[model samples]
Target: MTKCLGLVAVLAALGFATQASANQDVQTLASDPANWAIQSGDYSGHRYSKLDQINASNVGDLRVAWTFSTGVLRGHEGGPLVIGDVMYLVTPFPNVVMALDLAHEQKILWKYQPKQDPFAAAVMCCDTVDRGVQYAEGKILVHTADTSLIALDAKTGMEIWKVKEDDPKNGASGTGAPLVVKDKVIVGVSGGEFGVRCYITAYDLNSGHRVWRAYSMGPDADMLIDPDKTTSLGKPVGKDSSLKTWNGDQWKIGGGPVWGYMAFDPALNLVYYGSGNPSTWNPVQRAGPGGKRIDQKWSQTIFARDADTGIAKWVYQMTPFDEWDYDGVNEPILTDLDIDGVKRKALTHFDRNGFGYTLDRVTGELLVAEKFEPDVNWATKVVTDKSDPQYGRPLINKKFSPFETGTDDVTKGICPSSMGAKNQQPAAYSPLTSLFYVPVTRLCMDMEAFKVSYQVGQPYVGATLTMFPAPGENGNTGAFIAWDGAKGKTVWSKPERFAVWSGALTTAGGIVFYGTLEGYLKAVDQKTGKELFKFKTPSGIVGNPMTYMHDGKQYVAVLSGVGGWAGIGLAAGLTDPEDGSGAVGGFASLSSYTGLGGTLTVFALP
Candidate 1:
């Protein structure tokens, strides 16, 4: 008995030692910028992977390692979180969380499905898929479909706690991925299209306690005040001046949903998020009487807020009084670049308004603003001096204008469809190659406006956007372009049959990875944009691709299934469906592929 007791203690001690060593290794990997520690890969939000095990030279030998289907049929846009040998993913609708053992033939260690309210689906502007999950402080945090944030034991998939972000009766939900920095879990609210006041909030990871809340539209006095008591962006206005830009206190309920993934610079301590358009598709409703103040304070703007205090550092409004539903809620990628002659840290965005912008990360100054889209009639040019558009504002009563015409039809032929050339799907930058790889569409939209009315829960504004082929462009196809970030010039371009809906992933091996809407996952030459390798999946692929090494073997993974704005539009014939929509086609086809289902496909060297 004594011998047995001693042996048991020895085994226990060995287990402890192994756990400690494993934890230390994880800490080392997590802290390294080369391992993609943040959402966009090391706070720069570049979405570029540094490891280069699978280079363009050897990409042809890449084969599927394994595939895990979530069995949930909605749109799958969530990117996978690869930490060590375990990969974490979030699914749509029920918002189930799954942890897979990548080293063990993609074995599912555990799956977590948080209880969600069914009615929440009604408020989602897009599909119900959660963008991704955050890993911090030994916990995995995810936002559910019903506006609830749940923290789970990363290894066990057990729920630690849950926090509700909205009152179900008021109609608000969350679909974007939460950003975890230090001990705070930062998340933005969705449901702005449904007329809810949108805001971003931070919660304590340890206790699930609310730290601070910053509303997208609110009284100046109520905006997030710097707890440090610093006079940052000046004092908040009391009454009339605060509401001057907006008519009739509409600012109180104006919609500016921060629904897309946001990036952060820990060094600068600034959190950057692009705000959506104001409530009511009609600008006439929000902008009453006179134009008053030209640019709305923060709506449709790229906001730089103090990461710790939630105070506005600086804001650059992308569009003034956005009426075309071209919300600026795209990925704000952070990266360091050499602009012209000087080296500077920058935040770049491929805005939905048909322009790409590079701004000084610290001060929010526009450095370069150029049009990347083929056809953009709404805006003649983006004024870099003022960080505003020179010719995009719609006049209230002008003839032939989108607003006064009240023609909500596609034949009118507007350039750069609402989806923009690039949408929420993030692009990736390869420091090794010094080029930015993005999936761009060459489609146009004909938009007609409608008069809007302010209502609590109803869609006030109306706009019908019809997708058309670009002028002189062939089909509604997409192209993968490698852009010189510093020079703002196209390095290379490759035409694709369908839009590249997923985000790009560039590795150290000079390879750029992306998935197409038609379910083909391919690797392209990072420098030349040459298609080096390709593989087909069951359904269309829209989720971002992630690369990680497991058990000394590097693997690339992406979620497959189609159902976002672009996916829905293509499926429903809103745009020209590359798959040739069945004879009687319309928007009804948007929900047609629900049976297509969601899947997680992983690849590795044969």
Candidate 2:
């Protein structure tokens, strides 16, 4: 009897040890400081982590623990969200929602698939993929490809409610990530190429009810006569308003799609977003009736609108009557910069026009506008007060022809291609290093503009753009630039053969995480741009990197699949048609890896 009692006591002690270990795993995920709210670390849009367990010194020792492939194919740009011990991610095409249980060895808890329309593929100008989903109010909000917004229960992945935000007949969809502020889910409509007028809408989190809507172009009342009267914001002054800049109802069909990332400041109660370029490749098609020439306002502008009311607080137009396809749809990063001796809350954006701009978030004042590239000929310098550059204006010479706009010429190479310095990829702002890490494509384009007219359902304009090596540069690839926002200078840079399609993420450990078009996930020093670590995934990594703590370990996660615009172009050139029969030249390669599908891989320290 004594021996039996002693054995029972030993078994009880072992049971207590197992329970303690289980509790420790939960604590690691719950108390992790690196995983926080929103994109980056907070509302500031700084994608910097405060955890040092995976610092630059120890990053070299990192290894992959697991990978989750959705097999959805197409482009994989969705960045995953880590909350508690669960991981949430979005897939391409139909924009499926997935939840994974981290404590149970990264097992998928549930998957929510949205009903997508097959005809929607024909309207998508680029690839059919979403950047990511937003987590707010105990629910995961995902914008579907069918123009519907669905809310999922965070724990069960069950549909809480689904709301259709746009008319399917108008060719409107949601490809960009949804931004959640308090109870409002702010989202924008995409499908500019299909002649759809764009708009931004906000919805309630609890009820999935729309709060307010703001159109990119003014209504018929404002476009024809008084511009201010058409919009929610009152009229503009004299000739400065966008209405006076245009001629006779041309503003009615002007395109300014808000198909990019948005940032918000709770302190100021402002949600800022950048607008896309005008419709059609040709300005002649959008020019005023009878021969009147007018400059369209707000097409390529950064607007700061009230979060709750959808009222325009201030707008800084980057390119006023933009003849080039220079869409200002890049991510707008919010930060506080020390300009001269004054500390100002500034908004930083690396525009597609090859210029990096710093503006006062509160007043929309241009703080610093400088060219980050060497061969930016379109603009000599950005005006401090106004957003216009010093160079690149259209000249109306009859010799140019009715078919050709004077600005479009193959010989007169554009400084930055339509891809610009940075495209849709998100940049990282590290508060620890006081720097912004940007992945820039160092390439130029030979552009010949053509006269374009807006018709109901046909191609409106024509321009030929051929990618070339940067001026005095030999390669046609990309570079990782460490920009010091405080000093407005390039601290360090690393070049590559292919553009860095993936966005960047910085950690408190002084390491920056990003992926390359060549299928390598890399970790670099935030200050020196030194390559500390790298891991090759299934395919090229185009998505952003995110970090989360699970089971007492820090895990790094990213998606790997090749199907975006750049990926399709590169694959067409690299893969021979003979090698793969029945493959179309340009975007045909996008379907090659379509079967390989999309994947979300996670890594942890062993």
> Whole-model lDDT for model 1 versus the true structure?
0.70
Give candidate 1 regions above 4 Å deviation.
Answer: 1-28, 31-37, 225-242, 291-294, 386-401, 404-411, 452-455, 569-595
lDDT agreement with native, every candidate: 0.70, 0.70
How big is the positional error of residue 63 in model 2, measured in Å on the Cα after superposition?
A: 0.3
Question: 421-495, model 2: which lDDT tens digit per residue?
Answer: 787888889988778999887666655666555565444435555655577655645888899765567889898
Local error of candidate 2 at residue 559 (angstroms): 0.5
RMSD to the hidden true structure, all candidates: 8.5, 11.0
Residue range 392-474, candidate 1, lDDT tens digits: 23222232235444444333555566566777788888888777788886666556555555555555445555565567655
Query: Candidate 1's error at 12, in angstroms?
Result: 42
Model 2 clash pairs are 40-47, 49-508, 73-597, 228-235, 285-452, 408-449
